[model samples]
Target: MEDNYSLYEIAVCELIRRLSNKDDCKRYHEVLGYQHRLNHYIIKCRTHGEPKEFETQFNEIISQLNRVSLLELNVSFNDICNNVSREKQDDVVKQIPFIIVAMTQSEAAKLFENYNESEKLKLLIDSISKGRKTTHFIRQLIERYAETRNKWKPFEKDSRTISDIINDLLPKLIKILFPIREEEANIDLIPDYYESAFFSSNLEERSEIRDYFIQRDCIFIVDTISLFNPEIRDRFLQSQLAATKPIIGILPISKDSMAACEIIEESIKDKFEWVYERYQRKLEYNCSLEAYSLPSFNRWLYKILPDIVKRIPQAAPENINKMKENLKYNSKGFQKVVLSMGGAK
Candidate 1:
């Protein structure tokens, strides 16, 4: 981001985004039509209206945003109505800071700098509502994350082979995911691409890949961001019939949020009507999802490893302690990590 955008200013924009995002502002959409009007209003704030007037509609948003941040400011409603300048209306919010406002702009920037794509994604998702009571569901999501994959079939009598298509798609996959500067998310995309290729291969070929991974005790994972490939979608639908592997998917991005999220969603939205439908079914979707991420998944594994080791009652304490120091993860990893407490003494 440019220096012209202060972290405080960015946070304010983020608040603006949340108030208009499909996931966040369903309460306001039918009434305020934020979906269609938000960008127009942003432009209006610079021209026909002043910042103070712009914030007049944000009283409820201010209250809503208060729950997500660590701050609990007690600014009066009167202060919000007054004491705002055209150039620095966000200054008023300095007293009642939202997500990034709890700290100094510099402090917030430093904190944000360390956040990976998945972490930031989680933060943005969590900030949607004031509620924070889903720890158990999150644990379940992490458990599911350790076991997931997809399957695809090749086009009949196609001039090109499945491998040829995968070879072509591989370069494009790197090209898109590399634009993401966040290293963890970028690296995570590697397994997703290879997993997609594995699914797209013939049964014999896929079995080979599956055997190798199964022997190695590796789990295949798919995160947010699939391409606009119909074959992939059809393969996914076909695979779901007898699917033993439980899969968890995240919607690409809300209609708003980070600029990067919008770009990613827009590019692939056409191919993922199923995902978009899930977002549109917001309340139901929220009920089903527990918001798991890679870091949280690792933590879940670490937390459960001690109990898992207990299952191997005959195992040496030193060996069990060593295993606890470095936990392993995947579908098979989940099977091993989630062992029973009742065993031989």
Candidate 2:
């Protein structure tokens, strides 16, 4: 049986060789344009005689051309690898902020575990105020916490009220965190709102104050007078417009302060709208007065003091304390009210 199988394989191999040779001959004749001319010459030679000289010369020329074209195209493997690496790096850079933002609450907790709550809060606030690319992610984390749990409350000191802690630490913290630069716009506190005679004086007398307001990038109105009186509100709005400076009004609220609050709200809306139209730009005007009662205001102060510190990078303890003293003196015996504008919401 083995011998018979071997004989069959030999016969099939011989048959395949014959068929392959026949196909190759047919293909060689048909494939090349020069094959037709060669075939015609071959037929002529069969009928007449061989052209030895021309055939030898053509063969030699084809051999020389083949030898000349032997060099393969060069490729730089290193260059290709380097280009791919550069593209990958750029993609990673773009994704970094998003990756940070997408971290789970547990992941964020672990990332910040080394720092105390105050330190973590400070870092977050700093990251936000510096307009770091990572700010959006940080904000997302905060919002997520707010949604799932309550807002992340800061660690309180045992001896001091949150307000007192803020008053003591905020100014120094801001100065340390964000140093003043010559190119940066000034951040000024309107320490005593009553001392600003711009509202009572004519436009001419307020030129210096107007110019001062114009040059600043941010102004903190610490007093409550500007919010209630229409004329003072108009002047404040005008100053902001002249320089495109942002004003943060902090008003202490009380039972009798409703009218003032209404006036302030209207003034804010009017000014914001006017600015939007004049500049052909949209602006956001947010007031949280509705959400704040006296007790709630104290809590709000605790929650927002970090943000306020971030915004007013130039806040100094001396300036803040001076404002507080002036406020105390001017108020006589009214309950402390809190109103703030323009910071993280």
Candidate 3:
């Protein structure tokens, strides 16, 4: 029999050969095939019998493939080596981090492309929370994720609690994350765009929105109406998130229009709705989401709108002023959402 090499070993050989011949670059389909092969190869190498030979060969091939130093990949590889025991029952824990760090943003994304329900949370949590006991790290991960993908959520008028969380916690985290003077990086965590119009509100537009959220590793919180009458909005949110698995945090409204702000507190209560919490204690603030009045949120949102609008083509000069106005008006409605919660506690 042809040296019973696991699929990964064979794949490593094929990809290395392809890279050497530089053929994968020429064949577009091969690019896709290469990724599948790479994933399967990693899985096989990790779980199959005594992989020292495979690892050695894989390392040799990778050495040859190395054209540039990938800090993320190197760091991740080191992390894997420390965590896993290849000699044991395929304890491939270490490989997970390496695969995460090694792949280009696009390649890393493919790992989740075929994820089943149980597997999705692992990806989201590892990337954001890192299974650490620090809310600071988790929050920064969310913000950095937002910034990297150009998704910035301007604090809504009703997101007084969220605004407080952002303003109070964000600066402190930035200080820790960017310790050196040169390490400072401007990050935006809000969505690139937001349409209050739910799923039934638009089809093509909703799909685009879903894709946007998925790419950014984000979640959505539908307005209060969804909480009261969830049939349509819930379906809309689900349909939108079908392509991309973002947490959908639903905020319940009081329907008084004036008491709409209550949704902010309720939304935090429903934070698990955004991302499932197998262990609820792991959440920030004990998942006790605080409340920040709408004015507080709008102040920050309006401050950032000018700069944000400048980059959006759809937001023309005429529309810029209009958006600013809309933000102010929205802030009022949002404020109502927050203030309504005042009676609760």
lDDT of 2 by residue, 1-345 (tens): 123322322332222232233356763333343333434544565456565743553344334324223232012223333333332221100000000001224434444343235443344334333454454645443333221111221221133322333334433433444454322312332322212334435676566655654543322322222232334345655555322433233332333445545554454456555543433344322223232233443344344443433443333445555554543533222211111233111
List of clashing residue pairs for candidate 1: none
**Model 2: which residue pairs collide?**
251-339, 252-337, 252-338, 253-337, 253-338
Clashes of each: 0, 5, 20
Off by over 4 Å in 1: 1-200, 203-220, 223-234, 241-245, 249-257, 266-270, 274-338, 341-345
Q: Model 3 segments beyond 4 Å from truth?
A: 1-169, 181-193, 197-200, 221-226, 235-237, 240-345
TM-score per candidate: 0.23, 0.27, 0.26
Candidate 1 per-residue lDDT, tens place, 1-345, comes to: 234543343444444444443655555454244323434544567677577765664444455544443232333322322222122221110000000001122322333343344443345435422254445423322332212232111222233322233334433433342343221121111111235335545877655654444322222223333322233445444433112222234332333345535544554345444444454343332211121333332333233323323322243444543443333323222111111122123
How far in Å is the alpha carbon of 118 misplaced in model 2? 46
Q: Each candidate's lDDT (Cα)?
A: 0.33, 0.34, 0.34
Ranking by lDDT: 2, 3, 1
RMSD of 2: 28.3
Candidate 3 lDDT (Cα, 0 to 1): 0.34
